[model samples]
Target: MRHVVKEKSLEDEEEESLNRQRLTSARREALSLYRDILRATRFFMWPDSRGVLWRDVLRENARREFEEARFEKDPEAVTRLLIGGRDAVESALEKLAEKQRHQIQKERGDGR
Candidate 1:
């Protein structure tokens, strides 16, 4: 009976350790996503409708969002958030690139 109990305890410990490792990995991924967001914001040097810098606004929103999700424990939720954040950032950057390309084409057409 004692041997069985010890084996069960060992299994529990292994599971707990795995959970901790998963949490650590999730944290690393979240931090990386946050940094990517901040870096991307720097590319938007223009101001918004309120005349405030878009970079500052984006940084603030990103920080708030990360804070709000800091306590999330569910692995699935964390994965979803990370994916959604990445998609949003990629979409915004792509739109900005398209706009710039359109502007360049317009300028070249005018030049010609």
Candidate 2:
């Protein structure tokens, strides 16, 4: 009886740890995706000054994408979409960061 109890306790601990890891990863991914979306929108609308107009359109499209992906009900597909979206967003942000860095360097050169 004591051995069985110990085994169950260990199993419970392992499950808890796995759940915690999953939650932490999900939170990190969510933040990354959110940041990417914001950065991408800014990059798109900045020079042309269409931020306000584009925001509404982007929001609608984003909602539809989420709903469609969720409705698919396939774990693999869900994971792929979430990861793909995050990667795409991260890529956009990286591009924006590089552009900003270049612009800063140009300004410094002109100031010299």
Model 1, position 22, has a per-residue lDDT of 97
Give lDDT tens digits, candidate 1, residues 16-96.
Answer: 999999999999999999999999998899899999999999999999999999999999999999999999999999999
lDDT by residue (tens digit), candidate 2, 9-111: 8889998888677666665665566556765675555432645566556556666776665445344565687888877767766887888888898888962
Candidate 1 clashes between residue pairs 3 or more apart in a chain or in different chains: none
Clashes of each: 0, 0
Residue 85, candidate 1: alpha-carbon lDDT: 97
In lDDT terms, how accurate is model 1? 0.93
- The ten-residue window of minimal lDDT in model 2 covers 43-52
Clashing pairs in model 2? none
